[model samples]
Structure formats: structure tokens, C-alpha cells
Target: MKKLVLLLIVLVFACKNETKIIEKPIEAVKAKAKPTTKFILETLKSKGFKTFDYVDTKTKDTVIMQQYFIAFLKSGPIRNQNEEESTLLQEQHLAHLGKMYDLGYADISGPFGDDGDIRGITIYNVPTLKMADSLANSDPMVKSGRLQIEVHPWWAAKGFSLR
Candidate 1:
């Protein structure tokens, strides 16, 4: 083991060059292209926040997330709902959120649940949290006592697009 370790160390030292040495494959690697920030521009404009970048005059801010937390209740009449009722409720839940666009909300998902009555809460990115909060407070889900909403800060660190 001692001899093996000594040999390994020698091999490593022999392979390393102390000075800059151009090798056969040196030209193979080209400079990598910088990441584009185009999507960020459009997202900011759409949300009504004006954006400016030092590198480009046209790039938008896509990292802004107008988000909200919506909670739903699973107990009550829905406590013992059938498959048909379950499906209908699912549709209604999504449609209800979609309707919130009239009140200015964006990027919504889930009335999802895992146990009991299966409540769903979703996060949305909007121009302002107030709009989302108001929508949630006036939401049929909230009014029905089967849902609740909380507004909070949200952001997209990089890249933007509907998945």
C-alpha cells in the first residue's frame, strides 16, 4: 500500500505542467455563448412593470412572479362526494381560478389534494398581490367556505415560459 501510494503521487506530479502548455486539443474548445435574457423582458412588460437592462435596450424582466397562495377545504358536502362529483368539483375549481383573470391574476394551478376532503391551494403571479388577495377573498371557493387565500411574494429566478 505504501509503494502504491508513492507511485500514484509521482504519476500525478509528472502529469501536471507548472507552465502554460499548448496541447493538441487546446483549439478544440471555443468560448461558450452567454445565456440570453430575452424572455425576462417580455414577462416584465406583460406584468406592467417597465424594465431596462444594461446589456440590451430591449430585454424584459421575466423573473418577476406575481404569486398567491390559495387554500381549499375538503370536508362538508364534498366529504363524501362520488366520482362524478369529484370530477365536477375539479373542473369547477380550475374554472373558478380562470375566472379570476377578470380580477387580474396569472399563472395558476391546483385545487389539488391528497387526503380527507382534498383541499387545493395554488400560487399565482399577478401584477399586484392585492388583486390576487381580493380575488381570493371574493372567490367562490372562499365564499363557499371551502377555500382560503394568502398573498405572498414570489419570483422566477431565471427563464420564463408556460410549461
Candidate 2:
């Protein structure tokens, strides 16, 4: 694996109260993935994962492609009922992910809560849409009934180049 450095610049552009639509062609930047994004995905997989989707910049497919998927995972007495055991399971999962991906990571930046419910957004690299499509269906978390993960393609642009 190659060591990639991610440089992020947080730029705040003043915006009036208005809405607009913008389009960026993938072919223009398909040859390479952003350094920040590359690092993030790599670090995250190191934690644990069942499947991964390496996005094809040319295909224009991403978690942001969807409005935001709602997935009902599991948090029941019978599911990962043992915290210690669950911790081991999670560690194993991350180890597998780290071996599979280069360096994976994700950032949760915002004031949001599940209202007593546990929820979070996850991102990973995929080679294509099909890969991303299969992840949720076969996530280890889902299979073990320990985590209920769903993909919501609508990624906030804010954390794009997070360091």
C-alpha cells in the first residue's frame, strides 16, 4: 500500500438564502481519488467491515448518490448482549477491514442525535456501484445482529477533505 497525505482546507463561502444545482463530470477527475477521502476509507475499514465499495470516479456513484438510506440494524437483548464479547467481535472486524483496505477513517461532525437511538453515517471505498449496493446487504454487523447499518448516499460536503 502507498502512503497518501490528505490536505484539507476548510473554506467558508458566504451564501445568501437561496438554492442552486451544480454538476461535476466524473471523467474530469476519475483517474485519482482525493487524498483525504482515500485516507478516511482506509482507516475506517481498519475498525471493521463486512463489505466495501471502491467508488469509480468515472461512474459518479457514491453514498451521496442516494438521499440517505434508513436501515434498521439491531440493538436488542439477544443481539450483542455482552459488551465484552461485542468488543472482541468489533476488534476482529476492524482487523479484517484494515487488512482489506489501505487506511480507513470517518468523521462525525454535526449536532445530531438519534433521540436515544444509536445511529451514525459510515463511508467506505468501493470499486463500483454494485459493490456499494452489496455492502449493506451483507455487512458483518447486520449478519451478527449487532449493528444495523444503512447507506445514505447524501454525504455532507463539509467533511469532504477532513484531516
Candidate 3:
């Protein structure tokens, strides 16, 4: 992977009783380059992904595209459920996610390693954030207060995949 240093600027404007906020990335400044990992490159190649150009709908800028919808599952305010009930809820969560995977709503779902606050993530195949939220809200973990989900929409080139 190439190292890129991006400079971001935030602009705020006030007009009468309204406020507008804008954030823009100015340019990419190259950092120290490192050798590309062969294992990762080989793994990606095995998944049938190829480089392709993608144009941002909002900015109209073109760039290489490889993306997915990432749902960040964070720790919620409620986590006082008993062990027995928590076990059952976990079962339901897995079952619900398994069904979603089988039905093609979710492409990948897993936990982050020992990360605080942020618990896990789900990569959905859906195009819009609304659809991703609908699917995420169906998780038992999210419903039972064990986790809260935040959804992000992502896009990638056609033929992108993982093993």
C-alpha cells in the first residue's frame, strides 16, 4: 500500500440564522514509501479483484475504486443483561446474521480485535445507507442493547471480492 498524507480543511460560514459547514481534502502529500506486502497482494488477486477507475458522484473526481459498506458496531449504553440471556441473544444475533449472509444482504461480518468502544463491523452489499441501516437494525445484538451499529456506504470496482 502507498502512503498518502492528506491535508483536510474545514470551512464554516454563517448566514443570518443558518450555519453551513464544509470539509474538503486539498491534496495528497506523499509520505515515506514502504514495500508492498506480497501476501496481501496475492490474497487480493486470488479474490478476482482488479483495478478500475471510479468517478465520485458528488465531487465528479475519478480515482481507483475498491470499497464496501462498513457498519461499525459500538458498545451501547445498555449492557446489563444476565449471562443466560446474553448467551441466547448472542445465538440469535449469529442466526440473524447468518440468514442475512445466505440471502446476500451482508457480505462480511466480524469483530475487531480487542478494540474499545467499537466492537465489530459488518460489510454489507447494499447500495444505500438507509438499506444498510434497515439490515443493521435487524441484528439481535443491536435490538437487545448489547451493540449499536453505524453504517457507511462504500463502493468498489466491479469484480472486487475476498476469499
Candidate 4:
């Protein structure tokens, strides 16, 4: 009976030691893990994105700001396309916008609700105004003179979503 008790105690100690060993590695992994914000900032910087960080006084949280380009699609000189041509050009323009989103070049795009000089807007995620302008001009509507592009640099908080 005494020998059995000794064996059981030894087994318990062995189990405890194994648990401690496992717990140490888990803690080490946690300690080594980087915060998501830091990782994102580093990635953006590495990709040549212009960024700055600030602490929000209200929330006491760090906010990362990134420079993005906003392209305004305006009415161009040529607006006299035939009905079918106009429809086809519109389809091609939408397809171009979709490709931009899929390629991660453009974040969001939408047309205005009412008739206006500014027809729509596309927020480009690219780092440079030149790149954004080029992409915007590549739209079929712009290429065919149905639309014009005016690009400007805009700054916004990174990781923010439209509510």
C-alpha cells in the first residue's frame, strides 16, 4: 500500500511538472506576439504608405492615420453618346471599379444620389496621388470622355469603417 501511494504521488508530481512546462511555452508565445496595430503600421510603412500615429484624447487609444487619394468623377466634355453606347460605357466603368476593389487599389466607390457636376467618388487605397489619378483615368467612362477625374490627397484614420 505504501509503495502504491509513493507511485501515485510521483505520478502527480510528473503531471504537475508537465503542466508547468506547457504553461511556460504558452506564456512565452503570448509575450512574443505583436499587437495588431503595430503589425499593420509596419506593413503599411514597408509598402511606402504615408502614415502617422496619434493618441485620441477622448478614447485614450492610439489611432493610425494614413494618406489616401480621393478621386472625383465629374461630367466630362463628351456627354452625347448614343443610348446603347452610354449603357455599355456604364457597364464597363462598373467593371473597372470592381477590378480596382478586387486588386485592393480602391476601397470604396459610389455615385451621388442627385444630378450634379460631381457624378461619383472613389477612395483609392494607393499611396500616391499619381497612381490614384492613373487608375481613375483608366475607367472606361473617363477614357471615352463621358467622365473626368480630379484626384486629391485625403487623410483618414486607418482601420475605420463607415457606419
For each candidate, the alpha-carbon lDDT, in order, equals 0.54, 0.43, 0.71, 0.96
Reference-based TM-score, model 3: 0.58
**Per-residue lDDT of model 1, residues 63-156, tens digit only:** 4332333433344432355677666665776677787654445555564546645565555555565665766566554554445455565554
Q: What is the lDDT of residue 25 in candidate 3?
A: 22
Sort all candidates by TM-score, best to worst: 4, 3, 1, 2
Q: Flag the better candidate by TM-score, 1 or 2.
A: 1
Pairs that collide in candidate 3 are none
lDDT of 3 by residue, 129-153 (tens): 6777989988998998889988876
For model 4, state the Cα shift of residue 111 in Å: 0.5
Give the TM-scores of the predictions, in the order they appear: 0.43, 0.37, 0.58, 0.82
lDDT of 4 by residue, 70-147 (tens): 999999999999999999999999999999999999999999999999999999999888899999999999999999
Deviation in Å, model 4, residue 2 alpha carbon? 13
Candidate 2 residue lDDT tens string, 86-126: 88766754654444344432222121266444533345444
Worst 10 contiguous positions by lDDT, candidate 2? 8-17
TM-score of 2: 0.37
Candidate 3, superposed: residue stretches over 4 Å from native: 1-67
Clash count, one per candidate: 10, 22, 0, 0
Shift of residue 136 alpha carbon in model 1, Å: 2.1
